[model samples]
Target: MKATNKTEAQRIAYFGMKKMEKEGGYAFTEGTVSNWFNVVKEQDGTTYGVLLLEKRGVCNCPFWEENSEFGACKHIYWIREELAKEADFQSLTETDPRWLHGGGI
Candidate 1:
């Protein structure tokens, strides 16, 4: 969902991106369904995990639970951006042959 307050969205996205980069957040799993994103933040060496859902970037972060009724939180925004970049890079490489045909699962 789009934010009603565009300025707020931009501001949050900006800070989120910065914190994500600086803190080395966004860790994925190592399994067949590799869609889990553990957005982590380390404060005083204490790491906190914000689980990002596979669907629609919904997160388990308290900030998201409270502030994302209408719009996405910074974690979601940052994760979306990262996912988009991965998608772009994958598009340039080999993909599932089924997708090339008309029968992707």
Candidate 2:
């Protein structure tokens, strides 16, 4: 299914977290936040995901501009919430993979 709003996207992220916990040996502490990631806001308002690694925000959201939107990708927004307490998956920005939770802008 497609996430139509922040709330729904959060649920999907939670599912991804659960999967992360079971497979990667870490819990997705960023249920409401993410570590380093990229997001895509579709014309229909749906959001997709990309994990950020190193200093490169690799989210291919159609709205992204390499220089213009430098650090504001949805993946980063996912982990860096305004009210988050800083979680485990929140700092693995250097090891983000290209597959799994990925999409092109």
Candidate 3:
């Protein structure tokens, strides 16, 4: 489903969290550089994930490329909640990533 607004995106993020938890997913954060990581599952003997922080978030996963324009992807949503408590990313610069580009929220 496509998220038309911030509220909808948040709702989707909730579901994503649940799914992650059920699958034993986990995440890590680096407050200094504003980097967040999601411990992706093993697929084809490889472990990979999405990285989010500061003013931009990006996921190498296909899901992000397809659904990012609507709202923060699952990995991004998780990282946002985690970093919200530890970092002050309110003053991002132009060099930051463009994950929150359209300004939905």
Candidate 4:
């Protein structure tokens, strides 16, 4: 909940994306998300504050386009941040699973 900086927030966002992918809850058109994050620029006057407007709906905010709605919504912000963070951590993981269901299910 205390993602006080871009690094922390990015980490969470990555995790959320990963989870969504694994759960089959979302789909993407080949590198769209990658392109979103790839295009980052620092500008004046913003708060979600990092000018991640390019990655808008990357967060699951129900009120994003409603005039900076989710930007001020801490819960929504945190959810995305947490997901990002977790995904970042997961990328460093090694491929070693015993397959609890006897196959990679």
Overall lDDT per candidate, in order of appearance: 0.57, 0.41, 0.58, 0.39
Where is the poorest 10-residue window by lDDT in model 4? Answer: 37-46
lDDT tens per residue, model 3, 1-105: 566776676677678866765775464534444353644454433333556646657765555665676545666766666566444455555556642563223
Candidate 3 versus truth, CA RMSD in Å, comes to 11.6
Write the residue-wise lDDT of candidate 4 on 24-63 in tens digits.
Answer: 4232222344423221112432223222444454433432
Instruction: Kindly report which residue pairs in candidate 2 clash with one another.
Output: 33-78, 33-79, 34-78, 34-79, 37-75, 37-76, 38-75, 39-74, 39-75, 60-105
lDDT per residue, candidate 2, 16-105, as tens digits? Answer: 544533453222222244543323333344444555555544444443333223434434444444225344345435446522244211
Using TM-score as the yardstick, the better of models 1 and 2 is: 1
- Candidate 3 residue-wise lDDT at 27: 49
Which pairs clash in the backbone of model 1? none
In terms of lDDT, the poorest run of 10 residues in model 3 is 39-48
Give TM per candidate: 0.50, 0.28, 0.48, 0.30
Candidate closest to the true structure, highest TM-score? 1
Best by lDDT: 3
Ranking by lDDT, best first?
3, 1, 2, 4
Model 4's alpha-carbon lDDT is 0.39
Mind sharing the TM-score for model 1? 0.50
Ranking by TM-score: 1, 3, 4, 2
- Which ranges of candidate 3 are over 4 A from the true structure? 25-38, 42-48, 80-105
